[model samples]
Target: MNPFLPMTRQDMENRGWDELDFIFVSGDAYVDHPSFGPAIICRLLEKHGYKVGIIAQPDWRGEEDFRRLGRPRLAFLVSSGNMDSLLNKFTAAKKTRHEDAYSPGGKSGCRPERAVIVYTNKLREIWPGVPVIIGGIEASLRRFAHYDYWTNRVRRSVLMDSQADLLVYGMGEKQILEIASDLHQGVAVENIQDVAGTCYRVPDFDYVYDYVKLPDFETVAVDKKAFADAFADIYLEQDAIRGKKLVQRNGEACVVQNPPAMPLTEEEMDEIYDLPYQRTYHPMYEKAGGVPAIKEVKFSLVSQRGCFGGCNFCAIVSHQGRIIQRRSHASILREAKLLTELPDFKGYIHDVGGPTANFRRPSCDEQLQRGTCRGKECLSPTPCKNIVADHSDYLSLLRELRKLPKVKKVFIRSGIRFDYLMLVKDSFLEELCKYHISGQLKIAPEHISDRVTRLMGKSNKEVYRKFVQRFKAMNERLGKKQYLVPYFMSSHPGARLEDAIELAEFIRDLGYRPEQVQDFIPTPGTLSTAMYYSGIHPLTGEAVYTAKNPQEKRMQRALMQYWIPGNRPLVREALRLAHRTDLIGFDKKCLVHPEKTAGQEKNKPRKRR
Candidate 1:
C-alpha cells in the first residue's frame, strides 16, 4: 500500500475512515520527507495500522483555524517543526525575522510565538479533553524548568505551560511507539509515566523514588547560583545507562523526567530510513516556492545521527545524546540510488552527513558500554587516548556513492569537527579538499581567544591554526584554488570588549570578510545558554561576563564586519569604548584610517573613532 497520511477530513473520507486515530499539529507546512520530524512521526503512526491526519501551520489566533480537522480518536501530537519555533521567528538580537524557510513562499509570522505552548493551548480550547502529546526540538529542550532567552527569565517546564498530557524528549521513535501501544490497549494518558525519554506532570513527587531531585523551581527562578547548580546536575545525568529518573517541583505540581532513550542499532536505523518518504513538500506548495528548506536536502543523504563533539554551546548532546549512531552503507546507497531516479536529481548530491560530517562511530569503544563521562569531552582540550579517530568507513561510503551512475559530486555541507579531522593522519583531508568541497569548504572555529574558547568548550586557536595550515597545504598540493570559510560568533558568554577587539583583529589579519556572522543565541537546552541567563558557568559556578546590553551586542557584531562602510561608526565607537583608539590611525597595522579633508579623503575612507 502506498501510505501517504491524509491532511484533510475529505482525504480521510476517501480512505473509508470516519475518524483519525491521531491528528498531528505542526508549525511548518507539511513536508513528507524523512528529514522532517512531524512527517516521520505521522508516517510511523500510519505504518502501525492507525489512521493519521495532519494540520500544518494552522492559524493560531482563535478556534476557527484549529478546527480544520475535528479531533482524533486517540490523541493529538504537537510539534514546532524541525527547528525550534522561537529560533525560527526571531534573531539573536530579539528582532523579528523576515523569512521562514519552513513556511510556503518563505514567509514569516505564519506560526505563533512559543509555538508549542500556543498551539497546545488553542487545541484544548477547541477540542476539550483530547489528549495532547508534545514533542520535537522545542518541547524536548524545554522539558524541565530552565531559562527562557526571549523573556530574559527562567520559565517552568513546557509541560506545565502548555498543559499537555505528556512530553516526549530526545529522538522520540521508541517513546512514541510505546505510548501508542499502551493507548491502543486502553491505558489512560495520565498513567503513561514510565516510558523512557518522556516527561510528565504529577501532583507530587512522593511516588517517585530513587530519582535525583533538582532544586525546586522557586529557588532556581530567584537564585542565579541555584539555577546553574541545577543545570550542571541535569547536564551530567543525560546518559542513558548511567542516568536516573529526575524530579523537579513547581509549586504544588512536580515534573518527572525519565532517562534518555537508548540509541538505535544498525538494523533499527535501517528500518527507519527505509520508511517510504515522499522526499519533497506536498504538491499543494508548488506555487509558493516549495518550502525553501527542502532545496538544501532534496538530494542529500543522512549518513549518521548524534554528535560526540560535546560543544557546550550546542544542544545536540542533550537532544540526541552523546552516543554516535549511524545507518549502514547499503542503506545510504539505497537512498542515493532512489534520488537518482527522482525527476529532480540534477547530477549533484548536496550533503551526506548529519550533526557532524566526519563522525562515523562512537568517539571511543567504551561509549556503548558505559555512557559518556560527565565532565570530560572527546576532542575539545585534547583528544582522549581511547578516542578512535578513523574515517575509513565514511570515506568508503562516499566512494561508493560517487560510483553511482547519475551522481556527479557529493559534498559535506554539515559541520566538520576540524579538531578531530586534524588528529587523523590519512589522505582523508586531501580527498576532501579535492572532491567533496563545494567551491569553499566551511568550518566553525567560533572564536580565537583562549578564554572565550574554553568557556564555549571548543579547541583553542592553536589547534585551529594548525588545522588551517594543513588545509592550505592540502589545497596547494592538490593544485586546487579553494578557500576556507571559518564561522565565527560574537558576544558569547565570557567574551569581553577586549575579546571582541581581539576577534576583529584576527579577522583583519585573515583578509577574509565573512558574509554572515552569528550572534550567540541562548537557546534553552545548551550549557552556554544557562551561563548566559544565570551569568554563571553551569559546570564551574563561576561568574562569567556577558554582553547583554543592546548597544554592546551591536558593537561586537559590527566589529566582526568592520570592513563594511555602514558599520564604521559602530566599529569606531566599540574601539573607543575598549580604549583601543591606537588602532584608528592611518597605518597598515590599523583597522581604520584617521580622518582626512573632504577632497583629500574623497577617494579614501573616513575614520571617526
Candidate 2:
C-alpha cells in the first residue's frame, strides 16, 4: 500500500523510531503559486537548517502515510488547499446540486473539515506530545466567523473545530522560522506563544498589554468546547484586527492563543523574491506515474506580491498586501532563461502580470505613504479603494519578458482591469498591442449596473462599453483581430433582477454567450464578506444590497451559464419566475413584451420585487 494510505496497528509499529526534526504535511496544489503553504514553508525551514520531509496529499481515509511521516518532530505543520472557497464550494455542492456543484478536489463529498478531523486524530495517535500546526487559506479565512452563505447565518470560527495545537494564518514564512527556532531550543510546543502568526492555548494566559485573556490550559484541557466557544464569540475584538495577534477568551487562565504574523518588511519581501524558483513539476512525477502540472502548462513569470486595487471581493489586499512589490527586469530574464531550458518548454508563455497587471510601483510617493487623496475615489468608475497607478517598471519588465529566445509568443493572461486599461498612456497601449496579448485578452468588468458595479467596487459598466468600442477601433486601425474576453460577476449585493437581465440582454445583443459567469462566493478574509455581513463597504460607510436567498442566487448563477444548452430549462423557469417570460426564448414579440426590457413601458420583473 502507498505510505500515505490508512494506518493500521502495524502502521504504528512501522513508524520509524518515533523521532525526527521536521514533518511537513501539505494540500496538493501548483507548487509555484505564491500562496502554496507547503512549498514556501518547507523551503523556508530547510533554509534555516532543519531536516524537512513532506507528506503531500495524505488520504484522510488512510493512516499509513500519516504513520510513515510520524515522528516526535520539532514541529508538525498541516495545510489544507491554498483556497477556502475551493473547499466550501465542494461541501456546499453536496447539499445543493441545483447550484453549480464544485468541491476543492471535485470528489463527491470530501469536505475540508473532514481533512482536519482525520489528520488531527492520526497525529494524536502516532505522536502524542508532538505539536500539530494548521495553516493555509483554509485556516486563515475561517480564523473568525463573519457569515455563512450556504446556511445563510453567521457561524463560529473554524478554529473552534479544527483541533490543532496551533493555527498559523497568512503567508507564514517568518512565523514558521520562529516556531522551528523555539522547538529546537528545547521549548515545549505549548510555549510557542511568542512566535507571531500562531494561535494556541496556554495556561493562565494574559498578554502583557492586558486585554482579553486566554483560559488556563487546564480549563481548556478539561473542557475544550468551552475554550473553543470563547474564541468564537468575539464580535467586538475581531473588528479591530490588525496584522497578526493571538485572541483568547474573555477571562481564562494559562491558555495563550498567539495571534497571526505581521506583514513582511520591504527588505524581507526583496529577499523572498530572490529565492530560486524554476517553478516546475514535482520531483517524482516519473515514478509517481501522473501528469504533474509543469508538464502541459508553463505559467510565465510576472510580479512577485501585492495588488493595490482593493476590490472587496478579492483576498489579494488582505493576504499579499496592497502595496505592489515588483521584481527587476534582470531577475525576470533569469527566470525566463530557466523556463526556456525545461525539456517540455512550449513556444508560448501563459501570462506575465499580476493584480491589475499594470501596477508596478507602490501607489504613492513616500510622503503620503500613510494615506491617499480623499478625492482619489473619483478617478475611475469604481475607483478601487486600493488602486495604485504603477506603470513605469511594469512596462520595462514587459519589454524584457518579450525579448527572450525560443519564446515565440508571450501572453498577458492575467486579468486586465478594464477601467484602468482605458486610461493607459497611449504609448503603453501601443506596446500592449504590439508584443504582449495573443489576440484575445481576459478582463473582468464584473457587472453592468452602475449600482451593483460601484457596490462591488468594480469599474462602471459604461467604461466597459467605451473600452469595447476603443478596443475595436484600435484593432481595426492596426488591421488586427485582437479582442477581449470581459469577465462578469452576478448576484453581488445591490444587484437584483434588473442588473442580471441587463447583463443577459447585453450578452445576447453582442451575440456573445460566455462559457461561464462567476457568481460571487464570499471566501474568508475579504471586504466582500464584511459587506455581506453589514451590507456596507468595510472602508466606506455606505449602504449596500446583500443577496441572501439561495433560489435567487441559483437563478443568477444559471443566467450566467444559460448559454450552455443544458441550462436552458433552468433559464426559462427563472425568467418566468422573475416575471420576465418574454426572455424565455428571446422571441421578437418577447423583445417588445413591454414587461421584460426596462422603463415604464410596462416591462418589469413579474416575479417578486
Candidate 3:
C-alpha cells in the first residue's frame, strides 16, 4: 500500500526526498481518491516517478500555509477543486452558501472566491519566478473569456487573470505528463505552449499560427453579439479530433489554446484507476470529522469518463468533452472487489458510473474518427439517425458486479439518460428495475415545455413522457412499486412564466411534489450561460428570454413546488402574472386557491370544531 502524498516537509524527509518535483495547491481538502481531480493528477505524477506534495486548502489570508511545503523544483499546480469556486460558495440567488462539501467539516470559507486566481496569485507572491499551472473545473471552463454571473460582466480568461504559466483544460492526465516531461528536461514554461490541452499567453501573435482568433476581450466584454459569436465558435470547436487551435486577445496579451488532449484508451483508464489511492481523505482531516466530499464517492466506482448527453446547462462537454471514454469491465470489477475489502465495507456498493452512467461507449462510431458534429447534438431536440444507443456493456458490467460475493446491491445513482435508454431495444431497463434502482430512479427532464427544453438542449416533453410510460410499464411487469423522481429546472434561459406554469400543471397532473428544485444558475462556460448573458442562442442566433429578476426567478422556482403551503403565494402570483389564474382556484385541477377563497375558508373554519 502506498502512503499518502507528503503535505509537510517532515513527510518529504520521511520519504527520503530532499526536494519535490511538483507541489499541488487545491481549494478542496486532500482526498487521495480518483473522484478528486487534484488527487488523480498528483497521483498520476507520482506514478511517473516524480516527487509530488499537496497543499490542500491553504489559508490565502496568511503566508504560513503557502510556505509550509516550500517551493517545488519544477512547477506549482493549482486548481479550485472539482467545482468552480464561485458556484461552490454561492447559490443561484447570489446568497452565501454556509456548507461546502469539499471543505473539511463541511464548512464554508475554507477557500477564497475565484480560488484559482487567488491561489495562483499567492503562489506567485511567495515563489516569484516559479511556474504556476492551473486546471480543474474552474480553470478549464473559464479558459476563454466568459460571463461572470456574480459580477454580471465578461471577464478575461482565467489564464490571463491568474497569470499562470499554463492552463491545462479538460482531463489533465495527458497534458500533465507532457508538461512534466518537458519541465523535467529543463524546458521553459513559456516555450511549452504547443502542448495539447493547454493554454498559454503571449504578448503578441507572432508565434501563433493555424488558430481561429476569437473576438477580442474588449469587444466581447461590451458587445453582446461579439460575445455570442465568440462563444459559438468556442463551443463548436471543443472536440479533440476536429477541434482547432484557438486564440483570443486579452488586452495586450493573446491567450492561445492548443487542441484538447486526446481521450484516454481503456488500458490508460485502467492504469490511472489502478493507482494506489488511499481512497479516502487524508488522515489529518479525521480530527475535523473528515472531508464531507468522500462520503459520496468512497464506495462509488467510476466506470466511465465523459458524457455525450450534451445538456446545454452542463459543463461536461467543456471540461470532459463529448466523447465517452470508459474503463474495461475488468478494471471496474477490480475496483468493486477492492471496495469489498475495505474495513468499512457495507454490503452495498454506492454507485458504479461516471458523468452519465448508461453511456459505455461513444455516441456513434464516427465520433472516434470524425468527432461529434459541430453544432448538432446527438440526443437533443431529437435523437440523430446515426446515434448509437447501446447498454449491453453497462448492463453486463452491472450483472457481474451483482454476482460478486458480499455485495448486497449495486445502485446506478449517477444521472442516466432516459432519452438514450428509450432508444435502446434491450432488457437493460428490466435489469435496472430489478437489481439497480432502490425504489426510485432520479432523472433530469429539466423542463416539460418543448420550447424551453429546446433551448436547454434536452429532449422534448413527448420523449420524457414516453420514457416515463415505458419505465412504469417495466416496473409494473416486475411487480415493483418503483417511482421515477423526475428532476425539473426553473427559470432556465428562454423559460417564461407561461413555461413555468406549464411545468407546474404537469407536476400537478403527475401528483409529484418535488422535494428540491434546481433554480438555473448561469455559471461560466455553458451554452445556456451564454444565452442567459447574451439573450441570444449562440448556435442558432435566436432571441431567448431569461428570467433575471429575483422575484420572477422565485416565482418560477415556487411554481415547481406548488404543493408546498409556503409556496402558495408565489405560485398564485406566478399564475396571475402568466394570465394563468385559471389554474388558481378551489377546484381539484387548481394549483392553488384564490386569496379570497383562502380568507373565506379561514373565516368559516369554526365549523370544523
Candidate 4:
C-alpha cells in the first residue's frame, strides 16, 4: 500500500483504520511534496504512528466538503496554503488574478477569499466542539493584530477571526509534534498554553506572567502612531532565547503568543527532510493538469531554513525568526540521488537553497546562543562587526552536487544576500559565475535611493554597486557573456517621486530594461505593511512619505521600464511631477522626449536632401 496519508474515506478503510488522528484542511491542491506544508505535517504525523487524512481545497460555502474525511480523533488543522489567499487571488493593484498557481489547472477562486477563517468556520459548523488549529504562512505571520491590505484597516489577530483553539506559527515541525503529543495525552486545547511557537486566546491577562503588553486593538485601529508603536514592540521580541511572551487584547478575549521555537539542529533538519514524501502532487491531480505549484519545487531542494537578512518588507523574521538552520550535505545529496531515479529526472537541479541561498549557517556564532541583537540588523546599513560572512560550506555542497552522476546543472534561484556576498573573501562569486548561473544572474538591489533602501532593511546602495562591479569583473574573467538582471521595487513605504526618479536614472545608467517590476503590496505581518498602514516607521516612529496614489505608483513602475514606448507618458509625467523637466528632452540625459510645439515640429531639420 502507498504510504501517503489517506485523502478519501475509501483510502482510509483500505488501510483498516476506522478513524484518523488528524484531518488537515488546506486551501491548496494536494501536492505531497515536502515544499507543501500539509504534506510535511501529514508525513511527519504518520511517521509517529498517527493516522492522518487530508482534505484539500474543501468547498467553503458549505460543510459537506469539509466533512468528507469524517471527524478526526484528535483535532482539525487548517491552513491557507503556502500563500495568503487574498494575495493569491489579487494583484498588487487589488485586481483579481486570472489564475492561482497553487490550484489545480491554475484555476482561480478554488479556495475561499479568506481561506483560514472560512475553512475553520465551516469545520466548526460540521463538528462544533472539535479542536481546530490554524497554521502555515497565513496563520503564522498574522498571529497578531495586523493590517489587512484588502480590508485597508487594522484587523485583530487571525486567531480571533478564525476562532481556532491555537495557532502554531513558524516552521511547524517542532511545535506541531509538541501539540500532538499533548492532545494525545488528553489535555484540553485551552490548557496547552506553555508550548513555544504557539498562540492561544484567554479571557484576561492574569495567566500571562512577565509578558509584554501591546497597544490594544482599539488604539492601533484609530491611531497610526499607536499602530507603529505596537509593531515596534512586537518586532523587538521575536527571538526565542531572549524574547518575552506577548499579549494583545481582542474584544473580551486576549491573544497570547508564546516565544519562538528554537531552531532545529543539523540532525533534526535531516530527519524532517528524510520523510517519505511522494515529492509530487497526489495522483488524483493528474487529470487536471496537475498542481502547477509543484513544478518549481519538484527538482528543487530546500538546503536550509530561516533567514537573518531581516528585510523589513519580508515576513520571514516573524515567521521563521532571525536564525538559520541548515540540513547536512549528506541529507541533501541523498535527496539528489532520489531525484535521479524519478521518471522526470531532468539533469538540472533547479535550485538548492532556501530564504537566502548562500546562508548555510547562522550569521554569527554568538547569535546561536544570545539570539539576534535587539534593534540591530546583520546586513542592513552596514555589516556588523560580529557578522561572519563565509560561503565555503555552501560552495563545497554545490561542488558535491555537481559530482553526482546524472546531475547536469544546478542553479540558485532563491535570493542570495549580495551584501553578505560582498563581505566574503573567497572565489565563491567566481565559481558561481562559472558553474551555477543559468546565463543571466538575477539579484535584487531593490532601489537606488539610500533613504528607501534604509527603510527596506537593505544594505546601502554602494554595497549593491560593488557587488555588480564584482559580478561583471568575474563574468569577464570567465570569458562568459552572462548578464546581471537587477530587480528594483517601486512605491514602498519610504519611496517618493524623487526616489523613483533616482532609481530610474540608475536603471538608465545600467542600459538594461526590466520586463517586470514590483509595486510594493503591504501584506500582513511585515514592518513595511505596518508603515503602510500607520505612515510611520515602526523602528523610528517617524512619519514617512508613502506613494499611495495609484497613478503615481504606475508612474514609478513605468520609470523602471522607461525604454518601453507605452510607458513614455507615465515616465514623462513622473519627471514633471518631480520638477525634473531637464530629463524630458531628447538628449543623452533625458528619460523621455518632451512635448514639441506644432511650429517647432514643422521646422525640424531633415537629414534627406
Q: Which ten residues in a row have the lowest lDDT in candidate 3?
A: 600-609
Q: Tens digits of per-residue lDDT for model 4 on 216-309?
A: 8888889889889989989999999899999999887999999999999999989889999988887888889998988899999999998999
Candidate 2 local lDDT, residue 365 = 60
Error at 186, model 1, angstroms: 1.1
By summed lDDT, which 10 consecutive residues of candidate 4 come out lowest?
1-10
Query: Candidate 4 regions off by >4 Å?
Result: 596-609
Q: Candidate order by lDDT, highest to lowest?
A: 3, 4, 1, 2
Candidate 1 structure quality by residue, lDDT tens digits, 451-536:
99989889998898899889888888988899989898999999988898898898888787888899999999899999998999
lDDT string, candidate 3, 1-609, tens digits: 239999998999898888999999999999999999999999999999999999999999989999998889999999999999999999998999999999889989999999999999998989999999999999999998999999999999999889899999998999999999999999999899778899999887887889898999999999999999999999999988999999999987999988889999999999999999999998988888999989999999999889889899999999999999999988888999999999999989989899999999998999999988999999988999998889988888999999999999999999999999999789999999999999999999989998999999899988888898899999999899999998899999999999998898898887788877999999998999999999999999999999999999999999999888888999988888888888888899999987666767777756555
- What's the candidate order when arranged by decreasing TM-score? 3, 4, 1, 2
Give lDDT per model, in order. 0.89, 0.59, 0.92, 0.90
Could you tell me every candidate's TM-score relative to the true structure?
A: 0.96, 0.77, 0.98, 0.98
Residue pairs with colliding backbones in model 4 are none
Q: Write the per-residue lDDT of candidate 2 for residues 428-453, one digit (tens) a residue.
A: 66567767777877778787777877
Show model 3 residue runs off by greater than 4 Å.
597-609
lDDT of 2: 0.59
